[model samples]
Target: MVDDTLLETRHLTKEFAGFVAVNDVSLRVRRGTIHALIGPNGAGKTTVFNLLTRFLPATHGQILYRGEDITHARPAEVARRGLVRSFQISAVFPNLTVLENVRVALQRKLGTSFHFWQSERSLDALDERATELLAQVDLASHRELLAVELPYGRKRALELATTLALEPELLLLDEPTQGMGHEDVGRVTALIQRVARDRTVLMVEHNLSVVADLSHVITVLARGSVLAEGPYADISRDRQVLEAYIGSAEPEAAV
Candidate 1:
């Protein structure tokens, strides 16, 4: 029988020098869903990403993708299996033109990445694919511009386009809208919703509104453990979640 789960973890734990950064956290992500992980600073959100992507070795437990164990797979090996991550910080080639940045990513996906000496024009298929991705992210207008020269928000879009070039089944976004203005945040939110139409997205987002607007399921983490996990409405009203992460309200003085 085909496994229904796209990703699952069993007692997933990560430790640093005897300090448990992530403690026995188990999660299941269904295929083709947008799942959001939310928490305050230092709540082990990034640590979870590191462990899942194999940037850091798991102190214990198992990570399974499509019912197969992948706890100790190397980062590239994990990515090759169709799981890819976008870092919280923008990853782009600053000196390269926006089109060039995405073209390089497309080349990697097409198995022609080693052809460094060949002219980019020789890879017509890669160029075409990259152009399509640029359009999808609404960065086609800035194609010839230096990646560093584009506005901050557009830079994020460029990063998204680059990740798309990899053709991932699961996209891990680490604060995709961080450090953006209101308008930019709205744009990125819409872009994410568009992307989620076809791919599963697992994100660690601090922006409450973004989480409420984009997430189909929300998992709350506090002090290295799950405080709550459910649909938005259920988790939002959870008293334990409110007190531990959202803070309790103080009584107002009589008017």
Candidate 2:
């Protein structure tokens, strides 16, 4: 079947011991759109991401990617199918230069024979592509710095560049701007927007402005279930959503 939906979850549920983290939650992400998942703390947003990426097995339910059930797929299997995730913390090798980090990711995608044993000149073959990815993430100037030496925002950019090197069809971003200042947030937001031009992005983001600006669809989760789903304007005005945020006894900020 020619599926217009890039991703879907059917009655997805997750329970730890006797406690349910995600309870019969379902989602549909259309191809070529930025989808945002927003919620208060303990809302099971991270658990949903883990289930989709196969980091955690669902207590019950199914996950479909491009119409195929990925409920039992391995993390590597999902990633090979072009579903990649960028973590809240940067995922670059702290000791490696920004350029080298991207080069390594490109190598993983290429799977060259005896890749680790290949000469520096052979590895140089990936430099051009790595350079382009770095530029895309606005890390071109920091390409030579060790990943750990770069500023927090730039480290995130480098992680993004590495992820981009893999050319994922569906990108799962966890808090793309979690700890950034205003300037870095704007920079990362622009970078994400630019990258989503040709790919589908499903992001778990807290910043309402970023969510409102980038998402074509927004799904709000409260108490581990979908409370509302729509565009920013519609979801923003939802009475249930407003009440859910307001009712959070844990003092969470929500949009």
Candidate number of the best lDDT: 2
Model 1 segments more than 4 A misplaced: 1-3, 246-255
Tell me the whole-model lDDT of each prediction, alpha carbons only. Answer: 0.87, 0.90
lDDT of 2 by residue, 116-213 (tens): 67678988888999989998988888889888898899888888898988889999999989888999999999999999999999999988889999
Angstrom error at residue 55, model 2: 0.3
Q: Among all windows of ten consecutive residues in candidate 2, which has the lowest summed lDDT?
A: 246-255
lDDT of 1 at 207: 79
Best by TM-score: 2
lDDT of 1 at 9: 83
Per-residue lDDT of model 1, residues 1-255, tens digit only: 765589898898888889989998999998888999877677799999999999999988999998889998999999999999999999999999999999888877568889889875787666677889999999888899999998999999999999998999999999998889999999999999998899999999877788889988888887788878999889878887777654423111000
